[model samples]
Target chain A: MQNETADFEITLRPNTGWMQLDLKEIWSYRDLLFLLVWRDFVAKYKQTVLGPLWFIVQPLMMSVVFTVIFGNVAKLSTDGLPKMLFYLCGQLGWTYFAQNFNSNSATLVNNAGLFSKVYFPRLVVPLSSLISNLFTFCIQAATFLAFFAYYKYFLHTEGLRMDWRAVFLPLLVLQSAALSLGLGLLMSALTAKYRDLVHLSPLLIQLWMYATPVIIPLSEFPEKWRWVVALNPMTSIVESFRLMLLGAGTVEPLYLGLSVIFTLVVLVIGVLLFGKVEKTFVDTV
Target chain B: MSRPAIEVRNISKSYDLGSIGATSLKDELERLWKKVRGREVSARKGQFKALDDISFDVQPGQIVGIIGRNGAGKSTLLKILSHITEPTSGEIVLRGRVSSLLEVGMGFHPDLTGRENIFLNGAILGMKKAEIREKLDEIIAFAEVEKFIDTPVKRYSSGMYVRLAFAVAAHMEPEILILDEVLAVGDARFQEKCLKKIRAVAGGGRTVLMVSHNMSAVRSLCDHACVLHQGRLIQTGDPEECTETYLGIYHPTTESGVVDFKKPENETAWMKRARLYCDGQLGTQLEMGKPLSVEIDFESETEMEPGIGIVINGPEGAKILHASTRNAPSPSFRQPVKGGTIRCDFGEIPFTAGRYTLSFWFGGLSYDTHAEDPCFSFEVIERDLWGCARPYQAAHSILWWPAKFELQG
Candidate 1:
């Protein structure tokens, strides 16, 4: 059979010639996206003992572990910043990135029932998942600020301070969201056809954290080797986030610009691949 | 002629059945390699076509009923029109916002309260927040779950679940609404209410495309109907006429009271042939107050102790009589009863005069092995009226009893 070529307001064909983002279509379904995010946030904490408080407890515990292992045992320098405040700040952005990656990568498979029964922009699933994680990130960030205030004022930590670049925290969060969502979309589209990709994702995200400047400061790496690790787009985001929030790391414009460019490219490729896969994923999945 | 609300042109969907089985990485890589080399790709290995060159137009404000036997591309057509799945080769031009209820209660989380689920489900169905908020009270009243609206849906009864789910779907406002067998939910009274709701929705100058097995509902509700047979469009026109053609296609005739089950539809039961006769004569019409016999010819591989049954339904699909080996005589085949004909005879056929449908069934360990609906239909004639002062018509009562009247003087 040959593909159909027809003209109408909404023409459904086998495959379109080129990739189209249809941002307007996604915008029109904004209410649906909000509801989806609301369902995720509400349902995630529904029957739990701690409820949404677990959102705070999780990153706090992880930050404590990072302080013990990387600060006490490895003796990794937090660039002369307080160990507790520095680890909590670093955990803030890294946890959101990891959570978004984990959930958004499974969006298609998890929503197979909804996707097969309805007709909305398929992008809404992953987009809502990223937004839902932002809720948890906000709570975690508040807890981080609470610690930063206690250590800086009560404990009089001289090295720990906020700079004018702290205003750039929103930009850093957006960067983290874009990077995770881009890679998440790409993996989600592939995992629909290859079940093995689903099994490998958790380990990939773990190794990715170690490769980024999550637990260790970017200055800890040798000068030559630092550039190699800086190739990871997340490296700049993490470094810039710490530099802005705690005034400890360098804010290199070249590396930050590279990360932004890399994020945009991945976002474009991810959107195109995801759009193509969604048209027929129901059949294969 | 008004502009068509939905135009489906040369639509066809073919599935690569080969991929469903190749769950391993190596097999997928091999398939990819073959595609790169421009090979025949396993030469139609397990390939199947779900829909073939199906084209149709539905006018605005028209309620169209899609009818077909099972596996006849009815659901496939709905899915394509809903944009859930893309057609292999076709284009569908839908001129308005389309909401397809291929399933009701699609994303209702059990952990969510009934009130929250209503908003979530409405949003998933493409309703704006303000729209859902506006219809919230009416939806709650219709579902009759107002008391438990604040409680989690998981704690509700199954009947309540279906009611709430269907109520949300019924309240949706879309330019074109597509429903598939959603009317089969809820109780009989609720089903009637849903049908009325659907009729009201279509009356408001919106296009509706519904697929249902309820012939009576389709006949009463749809302005136009289409029949699909084995992945192809067989007929499309007036609702009553199209429905009659669909029923006729399934109601095959028997020769000398015997139907040869050589067709694929008949093989579903592992049955070779069947015969129905009355008083030892091969006849298509039977008289009331007479002996009747039903014979089933089946091929069995095991000891063959499966239950066999026959259901007699009226023209409107109401079951008049259901007789099974377990229900009545408790007949059991002896050890190792291999392939052969089993006959069950009734001393008096207690049915009134009219056309009745016969459906056969065989039950297996966990599920029904085979079932044929409207497999064979025969007319019942009142040969003798029993010299009654008043005669009863078949439409008046389904049963014929031997009633005797005597004066006490």
Candidate 2:
């Protein structure tokens, strides 16, 4: 008789961290994540009357509000650039960070139906949300670029200057994304227990926005207050925006360096907490 | 010996009970204060045991069946094995790639088409996008949804939706396949097709672990069955023996009668009484395949013409057969003695050994004239040697009857 046998024995280990993320198995399933992202984007506009146009409309309208409130009414300096361009850039950047964080924070809760019923990386939910948010970022960024060129040519002025530090834009984006993802992973884990994160989120976002230098320039502060403003990681990001794009401000190397350290620490803590929580979260979340 | 595909060792899972009694906002504040002071809190909290020290081994190519009721920790075990959730205490060693189809369409988005969701569901199941793309044609063909592959799944029929979902899962060939009751969807034929594929996968020296409540399905598909009850592993052995033990524990009775109908009787509009009035007699007992007529004696309290329907179901609420007399015209509306013995003749019985229930629905008369659950009782046994009932006619041929039949020409 011919006997056929299994090739290997099954073994269970604690967890596997591949690609610096939770749910490596889900990372293996990233095609599905891309599909889910496509689905999210399509579903958002599928039945809506305005469709993809709503993408540009949201940031465009936010820029209008910020230009009026901060530029004309409060008379905040736009670093010698057009108020619309300055406000629009800040809005786009802030929106990317906000959406990524908010969506990641909501990962477990929003996809509870799926998470409870199936076995996959729970992190996949938030990761897909980040990907979909990327769609919104691209749309807003393209709109801003068109306006930047129009203003530069029509106004007969270099409305937005270019600096070599612009090559490091990806690092700034990575920092912002990493910070939000870390905080989001942390908050999602906390949400399983407290169940009050949903109520506290908007309030937290308002306070966090004030902490960020989205509406104000970094140079406006006194040397002493600069330390406080630069304590926020985004102050380095926004300041770098002015330094690299408009040459109106200088980068805070000390503050930006601290922000990087803080980002790494937050991410490590987020992963540890999330790992601990995913093991037992089925009963709670 | 072949290497074992899955090894589970001393896995125990428990969940703490939530707060006792009604908790007001003030009580919550007081509780928080007590915690801050580091004082002794009440130890009246309870814990629910979902799985208690379950240990099992699945050798390569073994198709293992897990049979249990709801909250039996079947799903919990599957999650732990699939790594969706971790075991609280115990450890599991699994060999080769594992795919779990705990729920179909687990990550499906309503806006995406069948084509889009196929890739999405595949990826979630641990298949690469390129692999999914390569198998896209086969997946679409198996799902039989090529025509509407581009239509959003939200617009597809529930059958199509399940078919596409199952197809994606089927195409992702993992060394070990863990399925949790997803076969309950799709038609019987497609279910058979899926079962065949599972057998093929197992036959190819791969492992398959299935958690199912369908006793017959377990009997047919699993070489070995493990019974679980109330978070404890009760028994494990051959499929027939384990199922006998399981059914013995599950369907116990004081009267020693196999059938039990503790079904809550509906007080609203009903047939008054429904039972088999077969072979010119009215009896509570019945013989298998007995050309029986279910006589329903109903009376409409008010003058109304309502559509009457009957659905036959099993213990776990799976509808076996459902038909409605809604199309039949009742001309005697607004009259006395309007109801009679509505006899529906069945040539043969299609059931094996199991207790069954009867539920009737009265609809289309008024908004309030719906009989939600009119549960009653019936039974089927091994057939007799004498021909009592005619063959049950299908579109093609007669299904198998348990007993032998002699034809008198």
Best-performing candidate as measured by TM-score:
1
DockQ for candidate 1, C-alpha atoms: 0.48
Q: Which sections of candidate 1 miss by over 4 Å?
A: A1-9, B21-24, B30-46, B261-273, B287-291, B296-342, B347-375, B380-409
- Considering summed lDDT, which 10 consecutive residues are worst modelled in model 1 chain B? B261-270
lDDT of 1 at A261: 98
Q: How close is candidate 1 to the true structure, as a TM-score?
A: 0.88
lDDT of 1 by residue, A155-242 (tens): 9988777889788789888988888888999998888888788888999999998998888889989988878888889888888888
TM-score of 2: 0.78
Q: Model 2: per-residue lDDT, tens digit, B291-335?
A: 546666565544445456777665444677776664445432333
- Candidate 2 chain B: worst-modelled 10 consecutive residues by lDDT: B253-262
The regions of model 2 sitting more than 4 angstroms off are: A1-10, A13-27, A41-53, A158-160, B19-30, B37-40, B255-409
TM-score to true structure, per model: 0.88, 0.78
Error of 1 at A230 (Å): 0.6
